[model samples]
Target: MSLLDACGAGSSSPATAGGGTTAVLNMPFLEDMQVPDPDIMYEGEGVQVMHAVYDGLAQYKPGTNEPVPLLAESWEISTDQLTYTFKLRPNVKFHDGTIADAASWVAGFKRRAAINQGPAYMVAGIKEAVAKDPTTLVVHLKTPNNAFLHYLACPWHPFAVSPTAVRKHAVGGDLAQKWLQTHDAGTGAYTIKEFVPGNYYLLEKFPGYWGGDVAYDQIRITITPSVSTQELQLQQGQFDVITKGLPIPDVLKYQKNPDYEVPVTLGGTGNAIWINPNKPMFADRKLRQALVQAIDRTPVVQTSYGGLVPVQKGFWIDKLFPPNLDPISDTFDTAPLQALVAKLPDKNVDLAWGADGGAPVQQMAELVQTQLAAVGLNVTVRQLPTAQVFDLANQPQAKRPDLFIDWLGGDALHLDTVLRIMLRTGAKPLNLFSFTYPELDKLMDEAILQPTTDKMNAMYVEATKFVMDQAIFVPLCSQPFPIIARNYLTGIVQDSDLPEVIYADKIGRKLS
Candidate 1:
């Protein structure tokens, strides 16, 4: 059935709030989510759904990267940092009426490892996961990892699932992969009521949720691809909020409206241009450096995002890594770039941007294209859906775009997340350029084993500087996290670890 037919979406009235009535939160998805299963889904949109339907061992404290207790109330780490023991909360039950405990977590980890999808790397270091007892779970890693706890807190990390349900639904040893695509077996506050791909997903409050007294009774998420349509629906009280794809102009417009609450903060995400070194034109180090130095980022940031997002200062986002390192300049001389471009046999370059990025990213690409053309090159700009852009990573080097512009943030606040996921060898999906260096990979490997925060940060600094000097990835600007919601919607918190995800359980209606 269609979303409108199932949810009565044609109603003109806004969702009812307070006065002991069902509080439904209406939101829109800029693109259809891949799947709600935590083990397989890694994208931000799907992760949002997973956050509502699943509970991890730990979660980042609201507005901070610090790992705090969730399903696992308290945890202890070995001095060597190779072993971790977690104490699960008592009497927790999944949406399917199954108990959640040490065994359930162990099974979940095993299932994730066996499935071997994109997010499986998060748990690859697991040497063994054993149930010390009903409430105590012990995990041993192959090597010391300082970011282990942070990985557990990531939105894409392994979450507890119903072992009984998993076994019962297993078809030909599929580990319930098919069953989980449209269903949920988590212990979180919400359960998937209906999952209609490319249409809508309806999440109802799980009556047996361990967390007592959730705010919204239902969360209705419809696939609304157009940001303008989402804005209209929100204005007409059809949609309560537009989480993603709202342009900066509309964001500023809503900020002036008293009826809407627009919370804008410095997000962990940063926009960058990834130059494919495999391309013959960019193979030369001088040409790559010239390409990066050609663009003046000041106008690009101002014209595209209306000066809302600041030009990026470093390879990583502000305060995410240590300061005092050299900053990337906003402006550069194009004379050297022009000289270098004159020598190139092929000046034609294919530049692509994510369509899900909306209009700002396309504008940024056009501005860059203009800047590059002034330096004696022919640039062709193309807009592709975000999923198709990710698929480019798997394509052969000959088939990939010469340059890709997109914004990326770590799964967690740890420096390893950015270093290892985007630049490391064979990092799929996000590593569109397929840029890899053995020394860089080894440095990150050493950084993860550092004993103290200072030492770890120092290693990361060295790594960041090394990558910056390579000039393959050009930093553009910092993306500000903005959530436009109705004034009555309260408790909207943004986590630094996962900026794009809004925790549904934390949301509440402001009673009149």
Candidate 2:
């Protein structure tokens, strides 16, 4: 099959020339130079890159988007979906020439759960990672987690285990998280060679890989902090594979180019303006509505953002949802603004944006202020320092934010990441939003506490609606992610949802 056919075409953007194997990326956060154990990868991008380097018990087939067997020959889950048993591919071998064994898998699982933060909490319910003799590993969960198998397919699992590898470079928190950074213990297609944090990362094809040989000999991921520089590199033939983040217009340069081809994908993340419900001013939906309605998205998107489509729904707004339509640009609609002003506290609104000082937020704050003032609302905009923003965003339930903006892509390998983190009325340990609505919180409680998938999905829809109605956040447009790459890079997936993980697949590059 043709590489384009293999990747499957989409509406967002077109694909590049060459096969979908090789890739070049301008990774901004070059601070992460090591591929930490898949079981312990805290960052989403880290886990993405680790996908190609490490094999999970299950894998997502590139074009088909189906989760199929990889290291594990087959697996079984209880009807409750709480327990999972895997039958390993007995012939697989690690990079160091050791057999991939059940003991190694169990050891990695324990180490992952012991780590304090990130998605490892998914396995908190895992009662056991018992090795049934040698080829079998059975995991028993404390609860019937429907997302267990999917979570296992994530970087957190087919756990990266190294009998001696992780222990060698283990640091700070734990041994497993540290060692996998520079070492290879898994039977993956690629191996790490040079890692200079914040500068660049280099990976080489491993002949010892158990799965199959990759066509590319080397992959270099340089940290091009500037998005403009990345766009230039792709057009200038200096790079291959560009990830989305730039405006649609900025990407047009490459998209129209006949020398090579370029494509864009809608990565699976939803970006929104985070509002702290605890703040007295934002506490009122009227004030929140005013802010959302007042800002002019046209200038903001056309000028600041390149070509990202606008979204009105706070979360999961369907294709049919309206107000923001395609081809026709979005302007600051005043009808909703008038409706909001009528419901306000009858006073002028003064607000502060808690985040690093930026023109975008500053402009947004000013725009909101101007719109409200025309209708007798007073507005004040404050830009807090980055540290203060972080502190406030992470503040305990007792002290929560009034207005803040952030990006939260849908991620719950356990599938509950969204429900458990955002909609908690109850005391969920990881309630980042700290929003407590009797009805909303109760819905979340039911969703997480429920035993069946049917019930779980139903409750999730209800809870999501609650969040939307509450407008705990001001819905903004999702920024477009555009990638540009030079020819010779082939077999690259460039998945929009999780770009970091997509580049990690063993890409093929034909050197001239």
Best by TM-score: 1
lDDT of every model, 2 decimals: 0.81, 0.55
Q: Residue 67 in candidate 2 has what lDDT?
A: 55
lDDT of 1 by residue, 1-116 (tens): 33432332222123345346677788889898887777888786777788889999998887666889889999999999999999999999988797898999999989999988
In model 1, which runs have C-alpha deviations exceeding 4 angstroms? 1-15, 18-21
What are the C-alpha RMSDs, in order, of all predicted structures?
A: 3.4, 7.3
Error of 1 at 2 (Å): 24
Give the range where candidate 2 is weakest over 10 consecutive residues by summed lDDT. Answer: 319-328
Per-residue lDDT tens digits for candidate 2, residues 1-512, read 33432332211112432356343333333233334556545444355446556776875544232456778889998777667888988867776767778887887777666664555665677888899967898888886766566565544454556656666666764764555655556667766676666677676666877766665555566766455776555444445555544545555765776544465554444445566666555677766655555666555444444444554333442211222221222345666667666666755443565332233445555655565577666655666543344344366644454444444433433335555545555433334456677887566556665677567767766665666567666555543444555444556675433543554444554443
For model 2, state the Cα shift of residue 408 in Å: 3.3
- Candidate 2's displacement at residue 418, Å, is 1.3
